[model samples]
Target: MESLKNNFATKTAILVDGGFYRRRAQAVFGDQTAEERAAELANYCMRHLNFHGESSNLYRIFYYDCAPSSKRVYHPFLKKQVDLGKSDLFEWTTLFFNELKKKRKFALRLGKLAEEQAHYTLRPQIVKKLCNGSIQFSDLQEDDFCLQIDQKGVDMKIGLDIASMAYKHQVDQIVLISGDSDFVSAAKLAQREGIDFVLDPLGAPIKPDLFEHIDGLRTCNKAYTAHTQK
Candidate 1:
C-alpha cells in the first residue's frame, strides 16, 4: 500500500474560464478559427501536465462559459434592432463549443446568458475617449457598443466541481485559468482539502490579495510568456 501510494502519478484537473480565455487568447495569440482555437486549448492544457514531468496524469479539463444570447435587441446607434443570432459572435461561440466537445477528456459546462437584462453598453476605452473629448459623440461608431449580458450559473458550477473534486480526491492539483478573484473561495476550499491550487491568468494582471489563496502562479504556454514580455 505504501509503495503504491508513493509511486502513483500526480493527477491534475484543469478548469478554464472560457470567456476570460477567449478574450485573452484573441489578444495574445491573434484570431484563429474555432477548430484551431480548440486545438490550442488542448495543447495549452497539456503543458500543465509537464509540470510534474512523467508523473502527472490529466483527469479532465473543465471549461465554463455561457451560450450566446440569440435575442433581438435595439441598437441605439444603428436605429434598428439587431438579431444577435445572426451575429459573428454567436456563430463563432457555437462553433467553438462544438469543437471543444470533440476533444478527448474535455468537459464543457455551459451556463445561460441573462437575455432579459442584456443591454448595449459602450466599450470602456470608447467611453474614456468621449470623456476626454478625444472623440465626439457624432464620431461614435456602432461597433463601439457591445451587448452586455450577465452569465448565470457558471461560477456556481465551477465552485461545485472544485469542491467535488477536492472531497472525492479526484485530482492532486487544480489549475484555474482566470484573472477573476471570485474563485478565491473555491481555491481556499481546494487547498484545505490538500489539493494544490494553481492560477494561470494568461498574462492578465490579478489582484494582490489573490496571491494569498493560490498555491502557485504559472502560465504554461509560450504565447502567454511572449505576450507578457512585450
Candidate 2:
C-alpha cells in the first residue's frame, strides 16, 4: 500500500504565508525572501508528494504567499554594536534578498528552529557545545516555545488553490502541510468534490481536528523527514 501510494501520488502543491515566516522569525531571520522560501518549500513538497509519481510526473508545487517577499528588510534588531538602532542583519538582508531574487536559495529562517539551524544544523559545533556544557536543555526549551500570532493572507491562498485544483481536475490527491484549524472549510469543499485530500504532518505534532474533511493520511516518512528543519 505504501509503495502504491508513493507511486500513484501526483499533482501536489504547497501553500505558505509570507507573514507566517516573518512572524516565526519574530526578529531572528531579520530579513526574509518569499521567493527563496517559496522555492525551498516547493522543493520540500515536491519530494514528499512524489512529484515523480508512478507515472513519473511529480506534482507541481504551487507556492502561494504574499508578493514581493520583502517584509523584513529594515526591521530593527540592532542593540548598539557597530551602529546605533540600525538593522545590520536587515542591511545584510538586502544582499541576501538580492541573491535570493537571483538564485532563490537565501530564504531566511522560519522561526526558532530556523534560528538555531542557521547557526547550527546537525553541526559538530552544537555537538561540542553539548559536550562542553555550552548548550543545554534551557536553550532547547527557550527555542522551542512559540508565541502564536495571526498569519493573515494564508487562508485565502489555501482556499483558492485547493478549489482551483479540484475545479481544474489537477490531481488524484491533494496534501496540505498545515494543521491550523482555519482550513477545515476548504478541506471539506475539496472532499465534497470527490478529491482525495490528504494532510501530511511533516513530522510535526498534529492538532487532531486539522483536515477534518480529508481522509487516509499517512504519517510522515520518518526516515525521509527526520532531517527536516522542524
Candidate 3:
C-alpha cells in the first residue's frame, strides 16, 4: 500500500491541436517567432504539471498538425498563379515544426493538407458585406480571399493516440489543448478506462455539452493565469 501511495502522483500526457493552439496563441499572446512559440508550448505544457501537483510527471506532448500545402493555386482576383511554398507562412510553419522536433519528450504527429481541394475563399467579413449588399462583387480585392484547405488525419491521429494511451495505461491523466469538441468520443473512452481527462481550451469558451466529458477544466496560458490569480 505504501508503494502504491508513493506512486500516486499523476503521470500526464499532453495533446495539442496545433492549428487551434496557433490561432489562440496569436490572439491571446500575440505573435512570436517559431523558436519562441515552440518554447512557449513547452513551458505551457509544464505549467499543467504544476497544476496537477508538484509530484506529477510529464509523460510526453503530442502535437498534431498538417504540413502546409506547397501547391500553386491560381487567384481569380490577382489573375496569377501563386506558389504557396514561397510564402512566409509556409516558411514559418516549417521552422516551427523543426523547433518542436528539438524539444525533449515532444512528438510531432503530422497529417496532410488536402492539396487538391485547396482554393481561395472570401473572408467572412467580406462574405457578410457581399450578402448584405454593402459591397459589390466589383469592389473585391485579392486580399479579401484566403486559401482554404482541409486538414486530413489530424483528428484521427489524436483520437487514436488517446485511446491507445488509455488502454495501455501509459499515463494516469491526459490534458488536451484544443477548443474543438470532436474529441468528445475519445475523451469519453479515456474516462471509461479510468484515465483522468482534462481540457485546456486556452481560455476559449467551450460548448456546455463538453463539460460533462472532462474531469476538469484548466487553462495554462499566461493571460488566463494572471486573470484568475487576480
Write candidate 1's Cα lDDT for 13-92 as tens digits. 99999999999999978999988999999999888887633357899999999988899998899988899999998899
Candidate with the larger lDDT of 1 and 2:
1
Cα error of candidate 1 at position 36, Å: 0.7
Q: Which stretches of candidate 3 lie over 4 Å from their true place?
A: 1-7, 52-54, 225-230
Model 3: how far is 36 from its true place, Å?
1.0
Candidate 1 local Cα displacement, residue 10, angstroms: 0.6
Question: For candidate 2, what is the TM-score?
Answer: 0.50
lDDT of 3 at 49: 88
**By descending lDDT, how would the candidates be arranged?**
3, 1, 2
Pitting candidate 2 against candidate 3, the one with the higher TM-score is: 3
Scored by lDDT, the top model is 3
Better of 1 and 3 by lDDT: 3
- Candidate 2 wrongly placed segments (more than 4 Å): 1-9, 17-42, 51-56, 67-150, 218-230
The digit string of per-residue lDDT tens for model 3 on 96-167 reads: 999999999999999999999888889999999999999999999888999989999999999999999999
Q: In candidate 3, residue 224 scores what lDDT?
A: 72
> Which ranges of candidate 1 are over 4 A from the true structure?
1-8, 52-54, 223-230
lDDT score of model 3? Answer: 0.90
